[model samples]
Target chain A: MTMSHAIEVHGVSKRYGDGPLVLDGIDFYARSGEFVSFVGPSGCGKSTLFNIVTGLLAPSSGRVLVNGVETTGSPSRSIGYVLQKDLLMPWRTIMRNVILGLEVHRVGRAEARRRASALFDAYHLTGHEDAYPGQLSGGMRQRAALMRTMVTDPDIILMDEAYKALDYPLKIQLESELMDTVKAAGKTVVFVTHDIEEAVTLSDRVYVLKAHPGQLVQEIEIDLGTDSHAINERRLASAFNDYYETIWRSIGAGGRTEVAA
Target chain B: MTAFQIEDAQTGAVRTRPARSRNRHPASRRRTLLVFLQVAIVVAFLAVWQWGATGGWISTFLFSSPEQIISVLAQNITTGELWTDMGVTAQEVLIGFAVGAVGGSALGLLLWYSRFVADLSAPFITAIGSIPVLAVAPMMIIWFGTGLVSKVVIVGFSCVIVSLTNAYRGAQRVDPDLLDLMRSFGSSKTQAFTKAIVPGAMSWVVAGLKLNVGFAIIGAVVGEFISSSAGVGHMIVTGSSSFAMNQVLAGVVVVMAMVLAFGLLIDLLERALFRWER
Candidate 1:
């Protein structure tokens, strides 16, 4: 059973004002309910690609389609984004933060409140509805941020290095739980990160992007036998190590050229 | 698992002892007590001043006792002169404050929305703000005559510049990430300004307004002193010219009370407006 494409980007390019191109002629696609990760070194324009796909930035060339609708320069309502920072309003309680998107979209206040309440248990943020974002631990803040994104019920979610700041043990724990939650919710996700292990551990397929004027270099599919949580498998580690070495070699050559400039 | 059990046991013991209050050390309590003691010392000093004046250690001609000032206040109150003068001063102060605040906020928003306007007026605003209100009040009275309008303008002139500068800086200093988030969410330019910029600038705007309260009162009083036939400043001027030290002291006391009351009101407004700042 094949899933339909939820988002499609074709020959997209981006350049800042009077500057060199940051993203050059990239192509990517994600199917419904698929978890895809884009991994590359810093300044590889992974975030730029995420921004372009989410309609935050207008691509210099080419087109993007979300749910078969053109989204090149058009704002998308079906997409939800989680930035690197939690960006939670310090004045708002956890419950209020989660319902912010819905309120902005003009969803009925009562209905938005009800939907947010239902997500509390699933997001592991129960008994924290009254707590302000400042009172939360880093991990808990990220969890609340995730719940905020999910409460809008967007068909596709774009996360830009959302877990980059967490400690290693906490990162692994949250990644597993996030995978479980994503699977249960049955939403398509495009996660951008620079970590090779994180890319292989959570993604159904990983797209490796090249540095400086980022372009799609390779796409590797992971067949982890129906259980994404078994990311600690020995075979998987070896395969990820090989992929990491290849990526590191590519980045090394890219870095030398940058230094020569 | 053993480490977890041990940590849990420690936490349990800590929670059992009303740890929240226990965590507040003696040093913090001493610091709080010290602050109260300092306030008491100030009150005691004021009481000594009253006692020294009444006991004739200080001459009544130079320094009227607190009791003399209180009696004068009571006499003026019974004769209805206090209320009349207070009403006049209150009107000038309030009108000036309102005009200054509204005009300043509007001009500030205009400048914030237009970079070219801000660039054009920055130096001009600085020059005008540099001039003291005392120097301006007499000139304003000469131009507008000894009337309420002159006093209100004097107060407004003193206050508007501070409010404009603070509000403009506040509007300019919004977090870039918050703006980006709003952009990503498809907020229109107007919506973004309304939701993010206005709310973000409110605290600084309130700070500027609070500072301007004292300036407004001073402007009104100075304007009255320069030319007015009425108001608290006129009473002070008359008392000073006649060498009636008690009346002068009484007028000074009334002005001080007005300034303190306005300051308290501003503090209340700050609390009410920026409860989130807590």
Candidate 2:
């Protein structure tokens, strides 16, 4: 039998204490090694869905399956999450911050450092091991934050608009690095971003959601002609604009429908 | 030449002045000048004070000239009497500060952990924290006796409140996002407290220590005033009773120096602790 998808979200819905539905009947899945992104306007509960998937917040209804095993309301050790803010502890050095996950997992200090040090060269933070987070630039700090997640070696990664805080150039640079490393490692990624261009360039598939209940409106498979590892080169593809326009129109239509009602 | 010039030299690169300036920065020069002026003003004031007292223009018995104060200080120093007073006072301040600061910080950590304990103690902390050190010093002397123990108790009482308040505030201000991050990693509550709360609260705790320097000294001196034999406060009381204005002024000078020295110590400690911040 074939291996199951990396993760499956069944009819997940959430509401806060008799309040309006925050998320409605969301079904999502990512096959092994697939890159999936959720894009929407603000207040679409993109973050809420992300939290439900991570098991940080349990859905009011429905369950999650990881590798065909039913797991809901309990975070799997196989998943790693990177938030929008780098959240690197300002008092700790870059290396120490990266090893926080390993320390939490109770990995031996020497082995943890050895494993974490190997990724520093790829993350562009080799010389800054002892330097504190305040000394690093925003992009470098974000990279360190990613390293902190990636060093734990989880099979499934969740990034909530991780590059949204960066400027255009730095965002693209980090995105390219993220794609190269994550794809090379064959990890399943579930990303959330509001930037249509970012979603189209980096994701294998995109899920578009509408706000005020945050239901999935559309899912688009992106084909940029060639499966290139470098995300920067994919921007020039003709189909990139097509995918971008489709997602944009889907969200725009949803906005109009809400306004008219 | 223009006041500013950009000349193309090598590789068609425009060079504006040299890369580094050899002259002193304007701010540094201003700082040096200010220090010189300050010293000159103090010297001028002292010269006038000496002239006024010796020439019978002012009452030496009332005001006491700088020279007279200086001579008394010099005499105490040479006879090793000042050292004894300073040593006694320093012990009280240091011991009291260490006890109060450590205990207060631990109490703050406890409050951070248990909301119930924190809420219970909030009003009592405020009530006890505001009670004046002078108002309580006499009671402290009566309770602990007029020995070194009474002075130490007074000093500790004066300092513990600020330390506790600052530490609690610091712990409260630690970013909630960091705690969430820790939770996502499946870290235990103890891990979060030690890793996030303690280090995050350090700067505020250090600030509390700095503020407590004055509080500690004040407590020790006041306790001495109520009843004591060897402290600088005792020296001041004796000098006042005898109408020796020079000795009184000399004691004031000694207290000022002690405060300055302790302040410098805290500065060094702050630098050592927050090297990462720089």
Candidate 3:
């Protein structure tokens, strides 16, 4: 419980009843303020691992420690999760959707409104306060979801392919915004992605997972140290290809039986 | 859809061709024609009905003439009886609908929240729902007396199952992803219920409400038929007793208009509240 890591998983294993392990002996950690990524081919249990970390699903075996406290099988407000879909309540305005977490915690209505409202300008969502989620574009919807997740100021944020749905340009834009914001706020983030280039571009460290008894096979440190604030600029860096190549090769070398999503 | 338009076969291609007379502006002429047809049919039916009733082909006692019914309606309006009967029926319907909504939704939520209770009560609800509502009307009158109380009870009885079924389905059908997101925020069961489950099921609840509107009117009217001093149903019963065909038809027309009004009101309210949907 007193570990120095911001989050840790030890010997985590998962399986649906009587089924073969989807995740086996999965061990990883993110230090405080670290940006970590999990990369694998389709069906590599990357999402399963993220779901377990978010406490949305049980691990079947092993434990998850968030900020040195075991949070296995119990959801905690300290960690925020953003699923692939925006999951915005269609009935609520964008502002209200962003305030849902705070509202659930019984923060007074005005206070929650103020906190949520503050993000509108910062997140490029100004003047969209009264708009419903359905009215927004896909990229904007995801941004609102990010605003919702980050508004609560959770210590750890788990993203399960949060940007894959957007077009390339918006995906890069959002990816950049997300990293810069999380880095500036000093929050630990664990992102799961199918695209190795994205994994390398966004994270300080990328964990390569193998399918068919999904397990961590390699952990690569991305030391591009690029000065560009934009993800497109990061991708253009001379070192970007080397990092992408490395992660792709690592994933390609893993188990070929199971696919990733 | 714009990628492929229907072919103008004689012209061999649609995109290069100017619009045809029939297909011009897509729905332009079709729209006007449809509306015209609808109005023409209504007028034609009324003309035939009026002709038949006035011409003595159909007995006046059996099927009242349109003119006679209109005069009867005019008489009721001038005498204040139309408003009184309408007001009485509207009050019963509104009150019954309110009570039924509350009770039905509460029980439905209970069923959704508790597996044990839902399993136990499923068969009972089905059994009660199958019972013809009119059969219970007399018993309800005997128990609660010929007043608003009995009508409300019958309305609630008629409506609870419809609400319960829709609401319970709504709760059960919530997106698991939404539930997960709520839980990740440390929301308790009650919080999830209020914040996620209920909103997820609001559409279903609205559907049940629409169904309840018809049931509520039926229960109220039937209760009145069993015994009541003033209501649309009471007027119809009295008109029938005295063999006043015009009055009876007028009472039926009023009831029909009332039900249509209620339906339209609900539709408007739903549209306003869920404008975000469209």
lDDT of each: 0.82, 0.89, 0.86
Task: Order candidates by TM-score, high to low.
Answer: 2, 3, 1
Inter-residue clash pairs, candidate 3: A41-A260, A42-A259, A42-A260, A42-A261, A43-A259, A43-A260, A43-A261
Which residue window of length 10 is worst by lDDT in model 1 chain B?
B1-10
Candidate 1 lDDT, A3-97, residue by residue in tens? 44899999999999989889999999999999999987777898889889988789999899998888887668889888779988776789888
Q: Between 1 and 3, whose DockQ is larger?
A: 3
> For each candidate, what's the DockQ?
0.31, 0.52, 0.70
| A70: Cα error in model 1, Å | 3.1
Per-residue lDDT of candidate 3, residues B1-278 (tens digit): 24346667698676544345556566777789899999999889879989998788988888888889999999999999999988988998888888886578767875767888888888998898899989888999999998889888887888888888888888888898998888888888889898888878878888998988888888888888889999998989999999999889999999889989998988997898798898
Q: Model 1, stretches more than 4 Å misplaced? A: A1-4, A230-240, A253-261, B1-37, B40-65, B106-112, B138-146
**Candidate with maximal TM-score:** 2
Task: Give per-model CA RMSD.
Answer: 6.9, 4.9, 4.5
Error of 2 at A186 (Å): 1.4
Instruction: Please report the candidate that would top lDDT against the real structure.
Output: 2
Task: Flag clash pairs in model 1.
Answer: none
